[model samples]
Target: MQQEKMNRSLTLIPVVLFGFSFMALATVFSTYGVAAEISHGMVSGSYLLALIVMLFTAYSYGQMAKAVPSAGSAYAYTQKSISPYVGFMVGWAVLMDYLFIPMVNYLLFGIFFSAAFPAVPSYVWILGMLLLVTIVNVKGIKLATVANAFISLFSLLFILIFIGLSAKDILGGAGTGTIFNLEPFYNPEESFSYVVAGAALLCFSFLGFDSATAFAEETINPKKTIPRAVIIITLVGGAIFMTVSYFAHNVWPDYTTFTNADAASHEIITSVGGKTLASMFLAVYFVTVFGSAMSSQASASRVLFAMGRDGQLPKFFGKLHHKYQTPINNILLISVVSLLSLFLSLTLVASFINFGAFIAFISVNIAVIAYYFIRKKERSFKGTILYLILPSIGAILDLWLLLNLDIHSKVLGSIWFALGLIYLFFLTKGFKQRPPELHLGAAESS
Candidate 1:
């Protein structure tokens, strides 16, 4: 079999960065990030506090991405600053982080598509979206990038419209006369710790800033553009999320509006006006989920391809199509796994993919801390704590959440590990059989 390397032809300005943030918002928007800010009276001030934390961490990431634009993302960043073992774990943790995001978006797609087209089965929509993204990605990176750009544009417009419509309702006195009050902050029912936990959940929505870093090899002027993209996408995406979340609930200050166990998430935006606005919002929601899934599929495929080519995975997983110039095997694996995972979810057997994602986040954060600590910059203890300490604490909190995840999730995640380990074992053996001279090519290309 002939080797087919990835094309560095995908030179674009900060798209994957924007797409990452857009996808992240879509992933967590309907959940607590937007929901909490809207219904729980946590918008603006409290949400902004969460944003501050994200901004600091994102700045650190931006600096790192600029310094070393590579495929491994946190793994590469940490390795350069720390050790290869830390890099290995960061890579391991990212398997789920990158893989399950599409799963979350897939679930969101099923829900909103059901709302939009009541007659059709939700799983049908799920399957259709999966097939469509797979085909688009199977074409090549340039095509996938174009698709992502269009979807991201449409999705952004949709979010802005929802925010505008929600604002109209707020100003029109449609809200239940809750006097724009600051009383919620002092209410005994709410505590800072709960708020922090809520922020952690919300933080998930803002967690994809570094996603752009993974596409470093594909970007134009990456050393500069990639980092700028990270910051820009984070701020832009964060602004949209904060604005929507604040007003989504501001239009109806009562938490009861959305907290009901049977509440349709689509109702939050639709109830603001008439069926037209509601329908539009739902349409955007559908595309948002679709776009998120597509971007994630592309990212995941690249990671798998890179790993496979490096002799850290099965060689077949690394193969790029001779003509298409795409990672055909990697893309197929991602699409199949995602669809299978979706199938499991429909059967009520799918585990909590979010647990895997958060675990990856904690791993990345911890990796960053270790990297900074081992650097020979000779910085003071105070500087070290400011950058590294808080992030480590954040990782601990993330671990606590992962520990608290459902049994099915833990079980499935362990299964995922067993599979990875089996593959790793074969990968290790295969490397031992390769001629020493052949190994040099992988190193030089990498």
Candidate 2:
């Protein structure tokens, strides 16, 4: 078999630009903000805090991505740094994260599409969008990458315009008192514990930063480029999201209004401006969500394909097109799963998928801790505290959120995770034999 290598057409643009559009950004910030509005406010402040946390959290991944440059992201890093079992679990965790997230993105699109044009059933649009994206992804990576870039670029332009128009409206005295109220943080009425739990909801929204690591095999000068992409995408995407949150809060002001509009056209966007501006914003929303859905599908399929090639999944899943060098079978599988997910209730699909993400976040954090200790790479107590202790706390916090998920989502998420565990056991039993390693250095010297 040929060695695993990626075609290096991907640049920082695909890594950064594509996933930052309004549909994705809006869904993330608005969802978190809406939840916070019901539970509390200062979601804008919390978003800023998340950015800060991500900056520090991202540094370790940046270093590791350069050092390893593998396809499966945390799954690859944790395995090399620890053991294959750890790798297997990490892969299982992320497979859910990658799989469900696209479904969430597409479901959100279905919601908005149904709202924008009330004649069509939301589920139809959801399934249709999922099908179209799946077809696009199955064609090839190069095509998907190029499409992501163009769609993201257009989406970015519309978002900027939306923000500008919203800012002007706020300045013109059409804004509400909640726009200036930072009272949510100090308010006696808010539940602090739920707010902490609510932070988990925001966790998945900031996920695209890892796209760099996922695309590592495809990048030229991966060591230099991958780290740069990881850091830049995190900071830049964080900045844009923070700014979008700021504008969204300023325009809608009372976060509760968004939640009240739940499963409907978010009044937050409609409340922003004139029909011309609204039309422009709606157009922006279209591409923004479409890009996020597409990006998620593309990234998730690659992870599945890698695992399959390692004999940890169905053998047919490992097949790639000879000419395109793309994982055709894997992409098709992802597309089918995504379409199935979309046809179900959006809320139902989101419930099942959300915990996969929480578990992933928890698993990766713990893996970083385990890797450090197992390797004894650094012996200092302080280093241990910094890497292991903090991430453990993070993992614990994530698990708490997972546990607290509403009964419906929690039950579904558990079933899905259980299926993954069963699949993992079969793979482990089937491929118990170890493979030999090659040393290019020794061969060259000899």
Candidate 3:
């Protein structure tokens, strides 16, 4: 019997929108206060620094996408460029990223949705979102892309409104009275370590760009389109983050004034646009979270499908729906996992997701070095910088972030990695041979 494959239907616009939605532009509202306090009011600076660091990693991903345009993403790149053992491990690590991100997003959506509509139970909202997204994803990628684009437009609209209101408040002398203030970007009281710590936390907000690679199998002209979408989403999303955070910092320059640091953005919105607009903002924010859950779940299923196809996971995961050309089983698995959000705390979910993301980032950067330098022996100066120097910096920064993760995250992540090793031991039969590989036709459009 022949295996089913995803239809190559996604174009650059939908792919970029999907990436942006996965990043969830409204994250600034949820994280702004903590970021501000950690950076000592230098939220913009921290985001800028994080963006610069992520760009190196993004460049490496672009190169790898060009080389291996498949849905496997980091797993495929690491496996083909390095060792299959390492690839399986990378895939295992990313399970945390792809798997739990949807859970986290859904959890947030439940919390916010319930807060907006107190009569409905949060669990109902969570389960409803999970079911809706699972159905859309199982139907096909094109529908998911269309759904994401619609949600992304609403998110962008809210962001623009917030920015406009913030500028009006500043220029009208209600806040800082000037947009040229450097206080949001630099603070004499902020230590370098503080900014670095904030950057580590902010890394969570920038994770979705690489997720574009997970759709390579379904994306039209993926070799060219995926790389461009990855870079575009990262840069565009980073700019939006920094710009919004800057205005927000200017409006609420004193972190001590916030009643609750985590809720500071809400307070700022109320201050700038009144309670009515704040309510509206919260409603829109919920929409962004819903979109994020959809996008994250879709990406997660694709990664699992890639692994299943390659035999790194059970063959059931590799099976696609004959009619829709979608990975129905993997989509169902993610939906089941997302139900755990009702029982788990958001902080725990966020920590483990970050743990997985940083590990995968580190692995991908190393894959670039191995594939281009050690394996292929590419020696041109441009190649040297692209494959060696940038990736080295990316690896170092990712390691720094990994090491600096909170103790709970480190502990949980360590336990997860240990479990992955045990599974690998059995999967590879005591490391006697390379893991099985699945050939899913030629690489997409390379």
**Clash pairs, model 1 backbone:** 38-249
**Off by more than 4 A, model 3:** 438-441, 444-446
> Using Cα atoms with residue i matched to residue i, what is each candidate's TM-score against the true structure?
0.81, 0.84, 0.97
lDDT per residue as tens, model 1, 57-170: 566566566555666566566555555444444555566767777776777678767876799997888888888878987897677666667667777677777777766776
lDDT per residue as tens, model 3, 1-446: 66557788889999999899889988878899999888888888889899998998898899889888888899888888888899888988998888988888888888878987899999999988888888888888778878888888888888899999999998888667789988777777667777777888898789899999999888888889998999999999999999999899877788878999978998999999999779888777777877788888888888888888877888899998888988889889889888899999998998788888989999999998998887788769988988899999999999998888889889998899999999999998899977976464576322
Off by over 4 Å in 2: 18-23, 28-33, 53-57, 121-124, 176-198, 255-259, 263-266, 380-397, 430-446
Give the clash count for model 1: 1
Best by lDDT: 3
Ranking by TM-score: 3, 2, 1
- Which ranges in model 1 have alpha carbons more than 4 Å from their true place? 1-5, 9-13, 16-29, 32-39, 43-46, 78-86, 115-118, 176-189, 258-265, 346-352, 369-411, 418-446
Best by TM-score: 3
Q: For each candidate in the order shown, give its overall lDDT on alpha carbons.
A: 0.62, 0.64, 0.86
Across 344-379, the per-residue lDDT of candidate 2 in tens digits comes to 777777676666666656666666666665554544
The per-candidate count of clashes, in order, stands at 1, 0, 0
